[model samples]
Target: MMLRGALVPGMIALPALAAAFWAYAGEHAALSALAGAATVFVILVVGLLGITAVVLGPAATSMAGAGVVYLGQLILIVTVVLVLRGVDWLDGRAFALSAIAQTLLMQVGQVVGYVRARHEIHPGSLDRGAAS
Candidate 1:
């Protein structure tokens, strides 16, 4: 639920983070940050698509599907880092820092989006988590 809406805040955070990286660091760092941050966003979107497929299936299959998606994403992310590490123009410090920050920001966005949205767990739906 929150994952769809979470992207907005995540997008907003990127520019701010990039500006900070540019100001405190330098042009190379800024470029590295932009690349790293954007890559994370793309990876997250792709993972979401993979998970969405899981959501529409049977309960028995859902857990395995979700696990596979998560594990696959982790492998993809590590592979990206390794490949990027070999690039002569890349800044490992900036890339890793930016990626970590972007990840945390996106997760925070998801939580905030979830809290702000109306959900079935509230009093309006059938399962209110109250004793009858």
Candidate 2:
């Protein structure tokens, strides 16, 4: 039940993300607003996944979830860069570096958020399951 609830946001966001990406790609000139919206949606998905992994059982899923999240982020970055480059909106070199930087930042943020949530929920002991 808890795991299902935790996954709800990511599940919902996935479709919205697809729609946003489609819309962006369909446009002759993608709007910065659209890019920002897509980025926000991705962030939300990452946050939800990170939180879900943390809350359910950090030790059990943290590494795996983080790896998956990181990979997804890399894919997203590549997709975004390809789209932007195809549209001539961003230079390839700059976009590539930006993508790498963004992934690192996101990973750090996820770790911090997970640690905070873990402590908040279980004060001292870290052995308790998230369902507790």
Candidate 3:
């Protein structure tokens, strides 16, 4: 569900990031921007999948497990960025911007999911129709 939520945001962020890089830094920077987006996409998906398989799957429905998974993923993301920062193929500014944006949007999606989930689990708790 988290991944699904990110789909639309990714669609929006990626193209905008690309365009921004192209306009500000030219074709080479645009390439780096796309690469940065792809890298983040792969990292998040794989990290989430790993977490799902290892912790979330067995725990099933446990929010604590999800939190742990997210913490781990966050650490992994930071580590990856630090390690790859010096790579020649990566445009540092573009990579930093896109990665940061992607990560922030993912966090926002998670929060929204949590809110919707809380509402679903308790129906009328968040229902605007209740006032009608």
How high is each candidate's TM-score? 0.84, 0.40, 0.68
Model 1 Cα lDDT, one tens digit per residue, 58-88: 9899999999998998888898998889888
Question: What C-alpha lDDT, on a 0 to 100 scale, does residue 46 get in candidate 2?
Answer: 63
Task: Report the C-alpha lDDT of model 2 over 1-132, residue by residue, as the tens digit.
Answer: 323333344344434443554465533222433454345446645655664666467687777876776676657756665666666553334334333443344445545555555544456456565447
Q: After superposition, how far is residue 126 of candidate 2 from its true place, in Å?
A: 5.6
lDDT of each: 0.80, 0.49, 0.72
Give candidate 1 regions above 4 Å deviation: 115-118, 121-132
Cα RMSD for candidates in order: 3.1, 9.2, 3.9
Higher-ranked by lDDT: 1 or 3? 1
Tell me the TM-score of model 2.
0.40
Off by over 4 Å in 2: 1-74, 120-132
Report the error of model 1 at residue 63, Å. Answer: 1.2
Candidate 3 off by > 4 Å: 47-64, 117-123, 127-132
As for candidate 1, its clashing pairs are none
Clashes of 2: 0
Instruction: Report the CA-based lDDT of candidate 2 relative to the real structure.
Output: 0.49
Order of candidates by lDDT, top first? Answer: 1, 3, 2
Q: Write the per-residue lDDT of candidate 3 for residues 1-132, one digit (tens) a residue.
A: 655666557667778888899999998788778777767776776666765566545565556766776787778767877888777877888887778787677657756654554535466755765566
lDDT of 3 at 45: 69
